[model samples]
Target: MAVLGCYINMVHPVQAERRKALDRFKEQIRYARDFGCGIIGTETGNVHAEIIYTEENFKEQPYLDVVESVRELVTEAEKFGVIVGIEGGVNHPIHSPIVMKRLLDCVDSNNLQVIFDPVNYLTPENYMNQDVIIKQAFELFGDRIVILHAKDFVIENNEKKEVPVGKGLLNYNAVLPFIKTNKPYINILLEETKEPDIIDSIAFLKRIYYQTV
Candidate 1:
């Protein structure tokens, strides 16, 4: 289950650049099988072309822009028999579980699915409440989830900071049990990890992933 990381800013502020980005994404879709990959994964992007955090991303227009962008990508993916895996984050337009659910509904294409990253959703203010948020995500779109991005985060100076899977505060217990039960053998791609940490992260995930329910 190889997934090509074709990450790009789908909602680029400039129309010309946005079209070019989409064209490049479609090209990846066309050549996905050549790389022995059936899924092309990306984060639903920010309104800023620079990919920085902005309050504008939370507005309606950016959300609609992401919907249109994903629809276009899904159309190209459908032709190539590839899956378009969209990921959401705090900085992007499709920022929350409810927003992601709406995007999934509006796109309404079988080719469009999710690459869920639980750590990406955590904020300093909401980190303590992640159990509820993660559970809501599974309840809302567990069936649509195609991949999982594993990482951990900690709060430093009242801001969220990313770290390797087992080195920080992300509760894999909230995630792995659901994967074991519903999405057996699903790919859990690790991010924000380094050498010694990567090995420990994989071992950590395997331990929880194989735990009895």
Candidate 2:
């Protein structure tokens, strides 16, 4: 069964009520572990701006605040004995896979892992580089990929958009081969599930996916 690792903000920035969010985050991770959810991932940081890539005053990418926030998540994740994968998305400056690499290298925490979503690194001008992007991601993250945001993406009118797994620019069939070669142990977590129904998502992956016979 696909475990829903809630991507919604687990940590509310009500600095006064720090324990509230921390306690909730702990409960969710413990829930994941109790249910045998092999891995879970989430964004440890965000910007207040409405725009996806727009830089904010204090919450810029590689924000020190993010590191501090992750430290808290790390402490909670230890009890569940689950690996917490820190993701790089449009809302973050750690947009590239290499930034994920840098964070892993810097903190050197055994409890943290990578949630590879290669298309998040795509810029307007560099939209045609999914092949390069995915390859670079595999090279950088390698076996540390704990989970995959298994959805392809596109830039339409400069806004990021999600298309189906096999139909869009994601090249899921080929992409999975590379990911399997580099990080076979990691689960291909489905994200960007554009289908309105959960059943639709299962149909999509059943048609084109990485599996062993």
Candidate 3:
């Protein structure tokens, strides 16, 4: 039980009721705070299934809806003195670095921060430019990152699939330095890995992490 933070499923179907979602999130905040956890993490809602990244979808009302919902969640988080971490991805409303920054600025709360997962932002077209994307994410949300998600992505059948930290396309050589330099005390949570591979993933991450720093 090394984990001192809890990741809340804020994108469930029941979250469609925005008020209920906010209430549930606030309750989770209290639960985390009472249990000695300092952070409560969640992702923005899902994107349009048919067209994930479209100009119209980005400008749609749903995006603004998520923003407003997060703003309310952050306000509640402030009262509990627990951090509300938002994990953004290409399939969610806070998709890009720009949108992430915008949300941070809009929320304007010290308790509101990011749970960064680089693999979530990677797309087939931007896979080659991963260095740029990773750098931009650190630069834009560096001060706002409270937790880091350790995972990797692979292209199978022309679709992205999550894999263990070192088993896929993520370049830890580049990512580790950014984390070490900018959020040195941040917690790195492993995801998308089998239980048997957790130890190996942690060892691999620690090896690169120490080597980078």
Highest-scoring model, TM-score:
1
RMSD of 3: 3.0
Candidate no. 2 TM-score: 0.77
Strongest candidate by lDDT:
1
74: Cα error in model 2, Å: 1.4
**Residues forming the 10-long window of minimal summed lDDT in candidate 2:** 49-58
Give the clash count for model 1: 0
The residue pairs that clash in candidate 3, if any, are none
The residue ranges of model 3 lying beyond 4 angstroms of the native Cα positions read 1-16, 47-57
Across 89-181, the per-residue lDDT of candidate 1 in tens digits comes to 899998999999999999999999999999878899999999999999999899999999998988999999888888899999999999989
Q: Which of 1 and 3 is ahead in TM-score?
A: 1
Give all candidate RMSDs, comma-separated. 0.9, 3.8, 3.0
For residues 1-213, could you state the per-residue lDDT of candidate 2 as single tens digits?
A: 344354534333455444565566667787876677756667644454233445551344345556656677777778778777777865574656766677677666788887777666676677677678777877887677777777766778986677766556666665667655666565676666655644666666656644622
Provide the TM-score for each candidate, comma-separated.
0.98, 0.77, 0.87
